[model samples]
Target: MKILVADDSRVMRQIVIRTLRQAGFDDHEIVEAPDGAAAKDSVASENPDLVLSDWNMPNMSGIELLHALRASGNTVPFAFVTSECSDEMIAKAEAGGALFLISKPFTAETFRDRLSDILG
Candidate 1:
Protein backbone atom coordinates (compact mmCIF):
# COMPACT_ATOMS: atom_id res chain seq x y z
CA MET A 1 0.00 0.00 0.00
CA LYS A 2 1.18 3.52 -0.78
CA ILE A 3 0.35 6.20 1.77
CA LEU A 4 0.78 9.90 0.99
CA VAL A 5 1.45 12.10 4.00
CA ALA A 6 0.90 15.79 3.31
CA ASP A 7 1.75 18.62 5.62
CA ASP A 8 3.34 22.06 5.35
CA SER A 9 5.61 21.35 8.26
CA ARG A 10 8.38 18.96 7.33
CA VAL A 11 8.69 17.82 10.91
CA MET A 12 5.02 17.01 11.12
CA ARG A 13 5.19 14.86 8.01
CA GLN A 14 8.12 13.01 9.45
CA ILE A 15 6.25 12.57 12.70
CA VAL A 16 3.27 11.13 10.90
CA ILE A 17 5.48 8.70 9.05
CA ARG A 18 7.12 7.64 12.26
CA THR A 19 3.75 7.14 13.88
CA LEU A 20 2.63 4.99 10.98
CA ARG A 21 5.69 2.83 11.41
CA GLN A 22 5.17 2.59 15.14
CA ALA A 23 1.59 1.57 14.46
CA GLY A 24 2.90 -1.49 12.62
CA PHE A 25 2.33 -0.04 9.17
CA ASP A 26 5.99 0.07 8.28
CA ASP A 27 6.01 -2.32 5.34
CA HIS A 28 4.08 -0.11 2.93
CA GLU A 29 5.52 2.56 0.67
CA ILE A 30 5.38 6.09 2.02
CA VAL A 31 5.09 9.30 -0.03
CA GLU A 32 5.45 12.84 1.22
CA ALA A 33 3.83 16.05 0.00
CA PRO A 34 4.66 19.51 1.27
CA ASP A 35 1.22 20.86 0.59
CA GLY A 36 -2.17 19.95 -0.75
CA ALA A 37 -1.34 20.92 -4.32
CA ALA A 38 1.67 18.65 -4.35
CA ALA A 39 -0.48 15.98 -2.80
CA LYS A 40 -2.99 16.33 -5.63
CA ASP A 41 -0.23 15.92 -8.16
CA SER A 42 1.13 12.94 -6.30
CA VAL A 43 -2.30 11.36 -6.26
CA ALA A 44 -2.51 11.52 -10.02
CA SER A 45 1.02 10.33 -10.62
CA GLU A 46 1.62 7.95 -7.75
CA ASN A 47 -1.94 6.71 -7.31
CA PRO A 48 -1.54 6.34 -3.58
CA ASP A 49 -3.87 4.06 -1.66
CA LEU A 50 -4.54 6.66 0.97
CA VAL A 51 -3.94 10.39 1.56
CA LEU A 52 -3.22 11.90 4.99
CA SER A 53 -3.21 15.69 4.68
CA ASP A 54 -3.13 18.82 6.77
CA TRP A 55 -6.17 21.06 6.91
CA ASN A 56 -4.42 24.35 6.15
CA MET A 57 -1.82 24.39 3.42
CA PRO A 58 -0.27 26.89 1.00
CA ASN A 59 -1.29 26.05 -2.55
CA MET A 60 -4.50 24.31 -1.58
CA SER A 61 -6.30 23.28 1.56
CA GLY A 62 -7.03 19.69 2.48
CA ILE A 63 -10.76 20.17 2.00
CA GLU A 64 -10.13 21.70 -1.41
CA LEU A 65 -7.94 18.78 -2.34
CA LEU A 66 -10.68 16.34 -1.40
CA HIS A 67 -13.24 18.27 -3.40
CA ALA A 68 -10.95 18.47 -6.38
CA LEU A 69 -10.19 14.78 -6.33
CA ARG A 70 -13.87 13.87 -6.09
CA ALA A 71 -14.77 16.36 -8.79
CA SER A 72 -12.21 14.79 -11.06
CA GLY A 73 -13.81 11.38 -10.51
CA ASN A 74 -10.98 10.14 -8.36
CA THR A 75 -12.15 7.92 -5.53
CA VAL A 76 -8.88 7.50 -3.68
CA PRO A 77 -9.45 7.22 0.06
CA PHE A 78 -8.64 10.48 1.84
CA ALA A 79 -8.27 11.56 5.47
CA PHE A 80 -7.18 14.60 7.43
CA VAL A 81 -4.43 14.60 10.03
CA THR A 82 -4.57 18.17 11.10
CA SER A 83 -4.54 20.39 14.17
CA GLU A 84 -7.65 22.34 13.29
CA CYS A 85 -10.37 19.91 14.14
CA SER A 86 -13.32 22.05 15.00
CA ASP A 87 -16.91 20.85 14.71
CA GLU A 88 -17.35 22.82 11.50
CA MET A 89 -14.16 21.47 10.02
CA ILE A 90 -15.18 17.92 10.89
CA ALA A 91 -18.53 18.42 9.23
CA LYS A 92 -16.91 19.89 6.17
CA ALA A 93 -14.41 17.09 5.91
CA GLU A 94 -17.09 14.41 6.19
CA ALA A 95 -19.35 16.16 3.74
CA GLY A 96 -16.46 16.47 1.32
CA GLY A 97 -15.85 12.69 1.42
CA ALA A 98 -12.96 12.33 3.84
CA LEU A 99 -12.78 8.89 5.43
CA PHE A 100 -11.94 10.45 8.79
CA LEU A 101 -10.41 13.48 10.48
CA ILE A 102 -7.65 12.73 12.93
CA SER A 103 -6.81 15.60 15.22
CA LYS A 104 -3.28 16.47 16.22
CA PRO A 105 -1.59 14.82 19.24
CA PHE A 106 -2.84 11.43 18.05
CA THR A 107 -1.16 8.22 19.03
CA ALA A 108 -0.16 5.06 17.19
CA GLU A 109 -3.13 3.34 18.78
CA THR A 110 -5.41 5.92 17.25
CA PHE A 111 -3.97 5.30 13.82
CA ARG A 112 -4.22 1.58 14.33
CA ASP A 113 -7.82 1.81 15.40
CA ARG A 114 -8.84 4.08 12.54
CA LEU A 115 -6.79 2.53 9.75
CA SER A 116 -6.52 -1.17 10.49
CA ASP A 117 -9.26 -2.22 8.07
CA ILE A 118 -8.29 0.22 5.37
CA LEU A 119 -4.57 -0.35 5.52
CA GLY A 120 -4.87 -4.09 5.87
Candidate 2:
Protein backbone atom coordinates (compact mmCIF):
# COMPACT_ATOMS: atom_id res chain seq x y z
CA MET A 1 0.00 0.00 0.00
CA LYS A 2 1.11 3.51 -0.72
CA ILE A 3 0.37 6.05 1.98
CA LEU A 4 0.62 9.83 1.64
CA VAL A 5 1.35 11.64 4.91
CA ALA A 6 0.77 15.39 4.98
CA ASP A 7 1.86 17.79 7.69
CA ASP A 8 3.44 21.24 7.85
CA SER A 9 5.84 20.36 10.62
CA ARG A 10 8.74 18.21 9.51
CA VAL A 11 9.12 16.80 13.03
CA MET A 12 5.49 15.82 13.22
CA ARG A 13 5.69 14.14 9.84
CA GLN A 14 8.63 12.05 11.07
CA ILE A 15 6.70 11.10 14.17
CA VAL A 16 3.76 9.95 12.04
CA ILE A 17 6.00 7.84 9.86
CA ARG A 18 7.69 6.33 12.91
CA THR A 19 4.36 5.57 14.51
CA LEU A 20 3.18 3.86 11.33
CA ARG A 21 6.25 1.67 11.36
CA GLN A 22 5.81 0.88 15.04
CA ALA A 23 2.22 0.01 14.29
CA GLY A 24 3.45 -2.67 11.88
CA PHE A 25 2.63 -0.78 8.70
CA ASP A 26 6.28 -0.67 7.72
CA ASP A 27 5.74 -2.71 4.57
CA HIS A 28 3.97 0.10 2.76
CA GLU A 29 5.42 2.96 0.76
CA ILE A 30 5.20 6.40 2.38
CA VAL A 31 4.97 9.68 0.47
CA GLU A 32 5.44 12.85 2.47
CA ALA A 33 3.83 16.25 1.78
CA PRO A 34 4.86 19.43 3.56
CA ASP A 35 1.35 20.83 3.47
CA GLY A 36 -2.10 20.20 2.05
CA ALA A 37 -1.48 21.75 -1.39
CA ALA A 38 1.47 19.50 -1.91
CA ALA A 39 -0.66 16.68 -0.59
CA LYS A 40 -3.24 17.39 -3.29
CA ASP A 41 -0.57 17.34 -5.96
CA SER A 42 0.82 14.11 -4.54
CA VAL A 43 -2.61 12.56 -4.66
CA ALA A 44 -2.89 13.42 -8.31
CA SER A 45 0.57 12.22 -9.24
CA GLU A 46 1.20 9.43 -6.75
CA ASN A 47 -2.15 7.65 -6.59
CA PRO A 48 -1.69 6.75 -2.94
CA ASP A 49 -3.92 4.14 -1.39
CA LEU A 50 -4.51 6.27 1.64
CA VAL A 51 -3.90 9.77 2.99
CA LEU A 52 -3.06 10.71 6.59
CA SER A 53 -3.08 14.44 7.08
CA ASP A 54 -2.77 17.13 9.69
CA TRP A 55 -6.02 19.00 10.19
CA ASN A 56 -4.49 22.45 10.16
CA MET A 57 -1.99 23.23 7.41
CA PRO A 58 -0.82 26.04 5.19
CA ASN A 59 -2.20 26.39 1.63
CA MET A 60 -4.96 23.93 2.34
CA SER A 61 -6.36 22.19 5.37
CA GLY A 62 -6.91 18.45 5.69
CA ILE A 63 -10.66 18.94 5.44
CA GLU A 64 -10.15 21.03 2.33
CA LEU A 65 -8.04 18.30 0.81
CA LEU A 66 -10.72 15.74 1.49
CA HIS A 67 -13.40 17.96 0.02
CA ALA A 68 -11.33 18.72 -3.02
CA LEU A 69 -10.61 15.04 -3.61
CA ARG A 70 -14.29 14.27 -3.35
CA ALA A 71 -15.26 17.13 -5.62
CA SER A 72 -12.79 15.95 -8.18
CA GLY A 73 -14.29 12.43 -8.11
CA ASN A 74 -11.39 10.81 -6.30
CA THR A 75 -12.38 8.21 -3.76
CA VAL A 76 -9.07 7.43 -2.16
CA PRO A 77 -9.45 6.73 1.54
CA PHE A 78 -8.62 9.72 3.72
CA ALA A 79 -8.11 10.33 7.42
CA PHE A 80 -6.79 12.93 9.81
CA VAL A 81 -3.92 12.66 12.25
CA THR A 82 -4.29 15.88 14.12
CA SER A 83 -3.94 17.61 17.49
CA GLU A 84 -7.42 19.06 17.58
CA CYS A 85 -10.27 16.70 18.38
CA SER A 86 -13.16 18.96 19.03
CA ASP A 87 -16.63 17.57 18.37
CA GLU A 88 -17.10 20.11 15.59
CA MET A 89 -13.94 19.03 13.86
CA ILE A 90 -14.93 15.39 14.18
CA ALA A 91 -18.28 16.16 12.65
CA LYS A 92 -16.68 18.09 9.83
CA ALA A 93 -14.23 15.30 9.16
CA GLU A 94 -16.99 12.70 9.03
CA ALA A 95 -19.11 14.86 6.82
CA GLY A 96 -16.17 15.42 4.51
CA GLY A 97 -15.82 11.65 3.96
CA ALA A 98 -12.86 10.97 6.20
CA LEU A 99 -12.43 7.38 7.36
CA PHE A 100 -11.03 8.38 10.74
CA LEU A 101 -9.86 11.28 12.92
CA ILE A 102 -6.92 10.28 15.07
CA SER A 103 -6.04 12.69 17.81
CA LYS A 104 -2.41 13.64 18.40
CA PRO A 105 -0.28 12.39 21.31
CA PHE A 106 -1.26 9.00 19.94
CA THR A 107 0.45 5.69 20.46
CA ALA A 108 1.37 3.01 17.94
CA GLU A 109 -1.45 0.95 19.37
CA THR A 110 -3.85 3.75 18.60
CA PHE A 111 -2.90 3.72 14.92
CA ARG A 112 -3.12 -0.05 14.74
CA ASP A 113 -6.52 -0.12 16.37
CA ARG A 114 -8.02 2.67 14.35
CA LEU A 115 -6.54 1.47 11.08
CA SER A 116 -7.20 -2.26 11.29
CA ASP A 117 -10.60 -2.19 9.66
CA ILE A 118 -9.67 0.10 6.78
CA LEU A 119 -6.15 -1.09 6.06
CA GLY A 120 -6.70 -4.77 6.75
Candidate 3:
Protein backbone atom coordinates (compact mmCIF):
# COMPACT_ATOMS: atom_id res chain seq x y z
CA MET A 1 0.00 0.00 0.00
CA LYS A 2 1.18 3.50 -0.79
CA ILE A 3 0.41 5.98 1.98
CA LEU A 4 0.74 9.74 1.71
CA VAL A 5 1.50 11.65 4.88
CA ALA A 6 0.82 15.39 4.59
CA ASP A 7 1.80 17.98 7.15
CA ASP A 8 3.37 21.45 7.15
CA SER A 9 5.76 20.46 9.92
CA ARG A 10 8.46 18.06 8.87
CA VAL A 11 8.85 16.96 12.45
CA MET A 12 5.19 16.05 12.72
CA ARG A 13 5.36 14.11 9.49
CA GLN A 14 8.30 12.13 10.80
CA ILE A 15 6.39 11.43 14.00
CA VAL A 16 3.41 10.17 12.07
CA ILE A 17 5.59 7.93 9.92
CA ARG A 18 7.37 6.60 12.96
CA THR A 19 4.07 5.91 14.65
CA LEU A 20 2.85 4.05 11.60
CA ARG A 21 5.94 1.86 11.68
CA GLN A 22 5.61 1.29 15.41
CA ALA A 23 2.01 0.35 14.82
CA GLY A 24 3.24 -2.61 12.69
CA PHE A 25 2.49 -1.02 9.35
CA ASP A 26 6.08 -0.71 8.24
CA ASP A 27 5.94 -2.74 5.08
CA HIS A 28 3.97 -0.34 2.97
CA GLU A 29 5.36 2.45 0.79
CA ILE A 30 5.16 5.92 2.28
CA VAL A 31 5.09 9.33 0.61
CA GLU A 32 5.27 12.81 2.11
CA ALA A 33 3.60 16.12 1.24
CA PRO A 34 4.45 19.49 2.78
CA ASP A 35 1.02 21.02 2.36
CA GLY A 36 -2.49 20.30 1.14
CA ALA A 37 -1.87 21.66 -2.34
CA ALA A 38 1.11 19.39 -2.76
CA ALA A 39 -0.98 16.62 -1.33
CA LYS A 40 -3.63 17.24 -3.97
CA ASP A 41 -1.00 17.05 -6.68
CA SER A 42 0.43 13.90 -5.18
CA VAL A 43 -3.01 12.31 -5.13
CA ALA A 44 -3.33 12.78 -8.83
CA SER A 45 0.24 11.99 -9.79
CA GLU A 46 1.16 9.39 -7.21
CA ASN A 47 -2.24 7.74 -6.79
CA PRO A 48 -1.62 6.84 -3.20
CA ASP A 49 -3.58 4.09 -1.52
CA LEU A 50 -4.40 6.34 1.41
CA VAL A 51 -3.87 9.93 2.54
CA LEU A 52 -3.14 11.17 6.06
CA SER A 53 -3.21 14.95 6.25
CA ASP A 54 -3.07 17.75 8.80
CA TRP A 55 -6.10 20.02 9.04
CA ASN A 56 -4.45 23.44 9.02
CA MET A 57 -1.93 24.00 6.22
CA PRO A 58 -0.68 26.70 3.91
CA ASN A 59 -1.93 26.93 0.29
CA MET A 60 -4.79 24.53 0.96
CA SER A 61 -6.33 22.97 4.04
CA GLY A 62 -6.92 19.26 4.55
CA ILE A 63 -10.66 19.79 4.31
CA GLU A 64 -10.17 21.65 1.08
CA LEU A 65 -8.03 18.83 -0.29
CA LEU A 66 -10.69 16.29 0.56
CA HIS A 67 -13.40 18.39 -1.06
CA ALA A 68 -11.31 18.90 -4.16
CA LEU A 69 -10.56 15.19 -4.49
CA ARG A 70 -14.21 14.26 -4.14
CA ALA A 71 -15.27 17.00 -6.53
CA SER A 72 -12.81 15.79 -9.09
CA GLY A 73 -14.11 12.20 -8.74
CA ASN A 74 -11.11 10.85 -6.88
CA THR A 75 -12.28 8.29 -4.33
CA VAL A 76 -8.90 7.67 -2.71
CA PRO A 77 -9.17 7.02 1.00
CA PHE A 78 -8.49 10.19 3.01
CA ALA A 79 -8.15 10.86 6.75
CA PHE A 80 -7.14 13.77 8.95
CA VAL A 81 -4.34 13.58 11.47
CA THR A 82 -4.63 17.07 12.79
CA SER A 83 -4.50 19.10 15.99
CA GLU A 84 -7.81 20.88 15.45
CA CYS A 85 -10.70 18.64 16.37
CA SER A 86 -13.83 20.61 17.01
CA ASP A 87 -17.25 18.97 16.71
CA GLU A 88 -17.90 21.22 13.74
CA MET A 89 -14.74 20.07 12.01
CA ILE A 90 -15.61 16.47 12.69
CA ALA A 91 -19.05 16.98 11.21
CA LYS A 92 -17.65 18.65 8.15
CA ALA A 93 -15.05 15.94 7.63
CA GLU A 94 -17.65 13.21 7.80
CA ALA A 95 -20.01 15.09 5.52
CA GLY A 96 -17.20 15.60 3.05
CA GLY A 97 -16.51 11.82 2.85
CA ALA A 98 -13.43 11.44 5.06
CA LEU A 99 -12.81 7.93 6.36
CA PHE A 100 -11.56 9.15 9.74
CA LEU A 101 -10.17 12.09 11.76
CA ILE A 102 -7.33 11.40 14.18
CA SER A 103 -6.49 14.12 16.64
CA LYS A 104 -2.95 15.06 17.63
CA PRO A 105 -1.10 13.54 20.60
CA PHE A 106 -2.30 10.18 19.37
CA THR A 107 -0.43 7.01 20.19
CA ALA A 108 0.81 4.16 18.01
CA GLU A 109 -2.09 2.13 19.33
CA THR A 110 -4.49 4.80 18.19
CA PHE A 111 -2.93 4.75 14.75
CA ARG A 112 -3.19 0.98 14.58
CA ASP A 113 -6.77 0.91 15.80
CA ARG A 114 -8.04 3.64 13.48
CA LEU A 115 -6.00 2.41 10.54
CA SER A 116 -7.15 -1.17 10.90
CA ASP A 117 -10.72 -0.06 10.24
CA ILE A 118 -9.70 1.76 7.07
CA LEU A 119 -6.73 -0.14 5.68
CA GLY A 120 -7.93 -3.60 6.54
Give a tens-digit lDDT track for model 3, residues 1-120.
999999999999999999999998989899999999999999989999999999999999999999999999999999999998999999999999998899999999999999987666
Residue lDDT tens for model 2, 3-71: 999999999999999999999888889999999999999999999999999999999999999999999
Model 2 whole-model lDDT (C-alpha atoms): 0.94
Candidate 1 Cα misplacement greater than 4 A, ranges? none
TM-score of 2: 0.97
The reply for model 3, stretches above 4 Å from the true place, is none
Worst 10 residues of 1 by lDDT: 82-91
Number of clashes in every candidate structure?
0, 0, 0
lDDT at 41, model 1: 95
lDDT of each: 0.94, 0.94, 0.95
Tens digit per residue, CA lDDT, model 1, 41-82: 999999999999999999999999999999999999999999
Instruction: Provide TM-scores for the models.
Output: 0.98, 0.97, 0.97
Q: What does the lDDT read for residue 57 in candidate 3?
A: 98
